[model samples]
Target: MSEKALVHIIEDDAFLSKALSRLLGAAGYRTLVYGTANDFLTQLATLESGCILLDMNLPGINGMELHAQLRMQANRMPLIYLTGEGSIALSVQAIKNGAEDFLTKPVQKDALLNAIAHAFDQFQIDDLQHHRQQELKRRLGSLTVREKEVFDLLILGLLNKQIAYQLGNAERTVKAHRHSVMEKMCANSLAELVLMATELGLLDKTS
Candidate 1:
């Protein structure tokens, strides 16, 4: 979270772009301006990070068109759309097109900041979940075959003694395997272990 998240603005009007840059800058946000949707698209590959603030009406490619292209191409950044046409229909249409917020021209500083803060909160949430998923995969990788088998059974409400009987192993061996599973999965308790497995989509809900 540095000022590195460039809020790319796509507006043909140079004056509005300049005003928006100044406004966003005053609000402690890093800003960038694009004269057209094509310009933004061209620079997108060079941008490894940041969100987009798009103007609905543009010269070459429109904001809605750009939003559609980005969504189709699996662009991950949040998009906030701005427009002079403050019609309810257009606003609803913008939301349908995957715009995070629909704003009219002469943007209010508070409203703009609020929308951006919400978008960034979502961004942070997504970032955290992505990292957590990666960590889950890493932890799952750390589990041994035996431990994974024991984990599968343990989540099914099977106790150590039952698991031992099913696996044709000694009770102590089953306990050791279960303990190792818990440790490798970073689970503090059996219930927590089950929940972890459920979150990882390991649980068959139909069953």
Candidate 2:
């Protein structure tokens, strides 16, 4: 219902584009229509978080290719392929390439709406993940160099003495650094610290 959940319509056919916009608008969705893929790409950053209703056949970049490009660019916008009957194979490929959903040409209203609803649901999940990652990055950024070193070792299941030996520091100094790491990361215990490290990709980076 909010403008932030806009349905971006990229269809070549003027009539169908307008009709889709009207339909979505009547259902309490905001929409922005474009006649070509290029137009949509040009204004992509300005668009709010939402789903894309993309016709599989566009003038410049075809829907399949555009979908691939979007993925390559790390675009998280959920895509619903509005393809023709003959483009079933392409639609499958689109889904395989990370499209959220698809619909054949002459799409049923209920089916389209349902797909849009599902896409928005996915967007919510993705948005939450993105924000969580950002928060983790901020927390990581708050760590001092020594605290980060201590954190890396702590998550590696190291004892304070072992970490002190590895970092060429006293055990008491290592303990202080470890405490700082846990506090900055907002971790309550060693197990929670390890989980936070795992979630922040710190484990993978060290491994």
Candidate 3:
């Protein structure tokens, strides 16, 4: 788990929010408490990476509505729903909508901690993937226009001679461009280059 990972607690009940914060704090987890969905949205742009503990019933925008808004904005924060009135239908809907967990209030200590741990684990996985994607994008941006063209054709199973014929270049020039693509992409093999192309969604674009 990341040391800087925070848990955002958005609950209308001040007493419950404080109690939950204390519990999480005692367990060595950092928490930020918000009294309403609007309060949370105010800091949405600047919020740190972590999970959310959202109350089902809020003063203004309810939890489900807030969740929908986050989804629309493409926010991928892990969220756990806390409801005083447990409804199976609501729980099912939350899970289907990508909530990490749904728990009834006065949530069990073990259950809450476990859910938070799992959420943090998920956050780490997502954070790692996001970093890898950015790095791959950076590498791809380093390629010249001609090298990029060669990379695309090479991943599509084109031989050097075929790529040269398509681009009206000498076979040796195409081979040079292919070598540069392989080196710039830091791919050890043709299979690795294809995998990188897949990660960059180049295969989808070509298909």
Candidate 4:
């Protein structure tokens, strides 16, 4: 439903690309057309929020190879594969690699629009998670080194006395650090602190 959302079309066929662009534009969407996978790759980092409609048979890098590169680059945009001669194996691999959908050539208008809508909806959800992670990182940054140490131990189900023993600090000092950790992390309960730690991948780092 976002007017600013742009659909990226990476089809080598000039006529089909133009027609697809027109179709998306008319349906209240913006579009970027690339004649080659390399062209799209060049602008991948700067590409705005939206999904990708990639032709499976590009001239150089090809669609699946491009998808792999995007994965390596950590581009989480939704992708829909368009293939003129889609095989079961190819479609299966595409889906396994996290493609939103696979459509045969001469795609239906309604189908294409619906796929785009679904992909954009997913983009919104991903964007929200991304922002939440960023905020968590910011809050984590606000902690002092000692406070971070206290936070790490506290989330590990450690008592203040246990943490003080491990850190060679007095119990009262450990208690003060824990209080600062809770305030800076904006967590009211141990459960809330643990959830933030999980969201920020701090739990993974500790484990």
Candidate 5:
């Protein structure tokens, strides 16, 4: 995980955009600037995990519309909206639609920096959780047919003997499978295995 998250500034006002970039740069953040939404979208696929500072009023494809497109595509980058002549209704709508923060022009330096810090923190947390889920899926995929069966029953609160009886296997064989399940899943105990199963959505299906 990178300590300095990128701050993408999408504003048509060159002066404000430049000032924001300098401010963030001085605050130990990496930044990319775009004069329009289209400019930002051009490199969307290659953009790393970060947050966006979007200007509400742009020449074309405004901030709100771009945000809708980003959400539709499942983009996870947190966005903060900046507007010169913002309305209460617009602010409410932006927040309701998942904007990190909405700020009127002439935003205080502290407020802007605080919002950026908060957004970066959230992005890091979300990125970590996404990676954890991916790793769990990978571990689950490594299980064998028998090991998977044992794992399912184990998380369902089945004992080794009961699992062996249900699967028509010897108790010793079931025990071996159980051990393999614990090893392959990297689970420390039965409780942790159950928690992993729940996170992977297996518990609901089995229950």
Candidate 6:
């Protein structure tokens, strides 16, 4: 099976666009070309996973402007610039503005493939970290107001009797709620649960 990745080429030159598209397609990469910045933006909302190959110079809304637009929209898609010779300043600017890398035209097949691979590797790492943050938030949200209180106390090394006294609840009531808290948190051990609570800044105190 061909493990091809989708690549979006934002180039206006018909000859270069067709040639580049053919080169990438031959290398087992699914390719799409947009002739203008506006065209790319129109379809940006519908895109899921694809790295952008942008041209530095364009007729309306040039490459740098497009780069800023993507940032303003809070879209973190990987960008690789395709610029002409003597455009080092523009290439530097692209890197500062969050481009993964830029390729000078006429682009080399090996360099282009390597840049695409590197961009996707970074994209995967970013996706993983983003999901991990979401999961931590979900787990923390599982705690009830009262459960949070008991959890904080438990982390402080408070016995059930002390926790009951502190919260003005019976020792048996504290025990029941503690069990419920552990189950909701999916913590296998008291120490492990305490560590999770501490990492989340939910532990009121530690012994």
TM-score of each: 0.79, 0.90, 0.90, 0.89, 0.86, 0.73
Q: Once superposed on the true structure, which residue ranges of model 2 sit more than 4 Å away at CA? A: 1-4, 86-88
Q: In candidate 3, residue 112 scores what lDDT?
A: 98
lDDT tens digits, residues 129-156, model 2? 9988898899989999889888888889
CA displacement after TM-score superposition, residue 78 of candidate 2 (Å): 1.5
TM-score of 2: 0.90
Tens-digit lDDT track of model 4 for 1-207: 465678899999999999999998999889999999999988877878578999999999999999999999888889999999998999998999999999998789999999888988877888899999998899999999999999999989999999999999999999999999989988999999999999988899898
lDDT of 4: 0.91
| Greater-lDDT candidate between 3 and 6 | 3
lDDT (Cα) of model 6: 0.84
All candidates' lDDT scores? 0.84, 0.87, 0.93, 0.91, 0.92, 0.84
Which pairs of residues collide in model 3? none
Which runs of model 3 end up more than 4 angstroms from their true locations?
A: none
lDDT of 1 by residue, 1-207 (tens): 565456887889999889989988888888888899999899888885666888888887888889889988988788898888868988898888777899888888899889987888788888788788778878878998888878888999888899899989999999998888888889899998887877778888524
Rank candidates by TM-score, best first: 2, 3, 4, 5, 1, 6
Candidate 5 clash total?
0
lDDT (10s digit) by residue, model 3, range 156-186: 9999999999999999999899989989899
**Residue range with the least summed lDDT across 10 consecutive positions in model 5:** 1-10
lDDT of candidate 3? 0.93
Error of 6 at 40 (Å): 0.7
Q: Candidate 6 at residue 129, lDDT?
A: 71
For 1-207, candidate 5 gives per-residue lDDT tens digits of 376778899999999999999999999899999999999998999987688999999988999999999999989899999999899999999999989899999999999999988987877788788889999999999999989999999999999999999999999999999999999899999999999999889999998
Best by lDDT: 3
**Candidate order, lDDT descending:** 3, 5, 4, 2, 6, 1
